[model samples]
Target: MLKKEAHYQEHHFLSSDYSKLMKDPQIDDAWQSDIDSLSPYLERLTMREQRWLIGHAIHDQPPHNIAAKYGVSTETVKGWRKNAIKKLRNM
Candidate 1:
């Protein structure tokens, strides 16, 4: 189980650039549509994972910053983001 989880996290992560689209300050109809689509998937993740995802992905926060907020290491924050994406893909 541990090995599989590690493999999944390592292999399924997307570039931070993918989340940059949502980092824009503009709020438009298309942005609403995107959020609507993303909501269900994001809701399925653990609270910690969701927080990490939103911070790192949607908000374009650095991993270290997220880690500091969560009282975890930067790598742990990255793991949360990657695992959250893996769960989204598997769903």
Candidate 2:
């Protein structure tokens, strides 16, 4: 499902292989450092925000299904998810 793919992509981004790919001492050091620096910020998200992010990543569920789980309107769920990601990016 689309949601599953999204989840996989997120996990891939956080995986060791991805980290190792950034291991070039000269060229990739800065990139690697940047990802490392973001760890603390990522860790600071609220639990609900984190779950929503993971759900979004999986991309399996339609907005309506996600809304049902969260007891919100589909539009509201979409908005919350979008805002959550925007906040994460800003962090």
Candidate 3:
């Protein structure tokens, strides 16, 4: 598991960027639609899982760094990111 402080920092970083990106009307609409379409799959994820996916996607973080932050192996983070991409493609 990630340490509490690490998790808090990650969330803070992601939330700030998310807020800025969502202010763009074009990006915001597309993002909201994508989220709505993927709602079922997203709902199945835990809060931490959702945060990880969002953070990775929005920030374009490398798998290794994401794995370190999330306390998972790089392979595991890669798998989750791949799965998220697949889900988004289907949506």
Off by over 4 Å in 1: 1-37
| Candidate 2 Cα outliers beyond 4 Å, as residue runs | 1-42
Pairs with steric clashes in candidate 1:
none
Identify the runs in model 3 with alpha carbons over 4 angstroms from their true place. Answer: 1-49
Worst 10 residues of 2 by lDDT: 18-27
Query: What digit string (tens of lDDT, one per residue) describes model 2 on residues 29-79?
Result: 534455465545445444444445534553356777777876878887677
For 1-91, candidate 1 gives per-residue lDDT tens digits of 7999977764553435335434545536654565656666765666567667667655578999989977999989888888888898898
Q: Could you tally the backbone clashes for each prediction?
A: 0, 8, 0
What is the alpha-carbon lDDT of model 3 when measured against the actual structure?
0.59
Task: Report the error of model 3 at residue 56, Å.
Answer: 2.3
TM per candidate comes to 0.56, 0.43, 0.44
